[model samples]
Target: MAEQDWDSQTVIRKRGNVARVARTDSEINSARRAGVSIETQRKVTGNKADPGVHYQRIAKVDYADDVVPPPKLNNSVPQAIQSARQAKQMTQKELAQKINEKPTVIGEYETGKAIPNPKILGKLERALGVKLRGKDIGKPLFAKKDGK
Candidate 1:
């Protein structure tokens, strides 16, 4: 079989075992007005029975006021951990066992050679009955501007 010539104007053409369909300008415009990018529109509308079905655009939200900032870790973590453990009269091995962590991990955290993630830090806080994580204090440095 002879191969068919393909061009932008070709809407439904078969070339050997493969077929192609070109998109109309109105279809492209409809996709754009629906808030779908050109690239994504191809995939979304590829298998749809009616591509004209409108898609509601999701509104973007600012979460700065909704969520609390995570606690900041500092050099004092090592000292804090060590002091709390000593105050409780708990050995490194004992503290590690309580937190289900290795003794060497506890040692490293106390020596300031390693930092614990939030989960591990929470465990340490619970075990030592001390707040290793810093509290969120003070206002943000920048002020929000009102629309002029």
Candidate 2:
């Protein structure tokens, strides 16, 4: 294969698309070890002028009052599961392989009406590399009690 010019090549980083030229798997691992999520503003090449270079994550998320609950979103649990899976770069087959299950199980998992068990949750956490509990996603933030 012919060598591509470094300047012309747009090296897309995996996991989170942070810009880095000719990044290896080691670099990606190192970056992850350094906690390079979308949370803190970290420079890739130390170019302050570049918005794409110094991107930051939002800490506090706002919950809109008008927002509908999860049951209203897509088909429910599976949709959230599906979205989170995609965000973590996991295909159903890949996730299934990690959980030591067949690909068909994963398909059922993403579309079935059955509530996910702890074993399945464990697989999901490992596969997506994120927590599945709490304000995980796709659920509305409920109003607090007034303590009347």
Candidate 3:
């Protein structure tokens, strides 16, 4: 008889006569218990066991059939700034004037292509009555052993 193709689950035996079992993690485990060499190959001289699953599956699925979605995130600080200015019933020119800055400065802060200076941030907060520091000060630490 032709030798069977080897899969992860294909079983091999040490001799011509032995009980056939569907190869499995538990079967390998039992072999471990009964003093079978975990890494050694031995000569077998008889009928092959039927092909079957090896590992005990927690669950199984066809991964090729999944429809995964791309991740979503926010880049909305600029839009938030614009909307807040609008809610305060101010134009770009008016906002700039109230903050004692240029309209282009306000535009840059709103678009997020530039970071606001401390003075500008303070003026914007005071003028617009909104806090722009969404930076979390109270989040839990996942610090390393050195507490870095």
**Which candidate should be chosen as best, given lDDT against the real structure?**
1
* Per-residue alpha-carbon lDDT of candidate 3 for residues 19-113, written as tens digits (9 for 90 to 100): 55536789889888998756634443332352244322312344545758543212555666677788879998999999899999888778776
Task: Tell me the tens digit of each residue's lDDT in model 2 across 3-117.
Answer: 9787776658658855664256787677788886523444454446765733333212223445674332225557767877787688888888888988877787678544557
Q: Model 1: clashing residue pairs?
A: none
Task: Give the candidates in order of lDDT, highest first.
Answer: 1, 3, 2
* Superposed model 3: Cα runs more than 4 Å off: 1-74, 136-148
TM-score for each predicted model, relative to the true structure: 0.43, 0.36, 0.39
- Go through the candidates in order and give each one's C-alpha lDDT: 0.70, 0.62, 0.64
Give the true-structure RMSD of model 3.
20.4
| Per-residue lDDT of model 1, residues 1-148, tens digit only | 9876675375486658432232888887876787764553345433377556533321123344467755445777888888878888999999999999999989888886774587988788878777777652121223368878
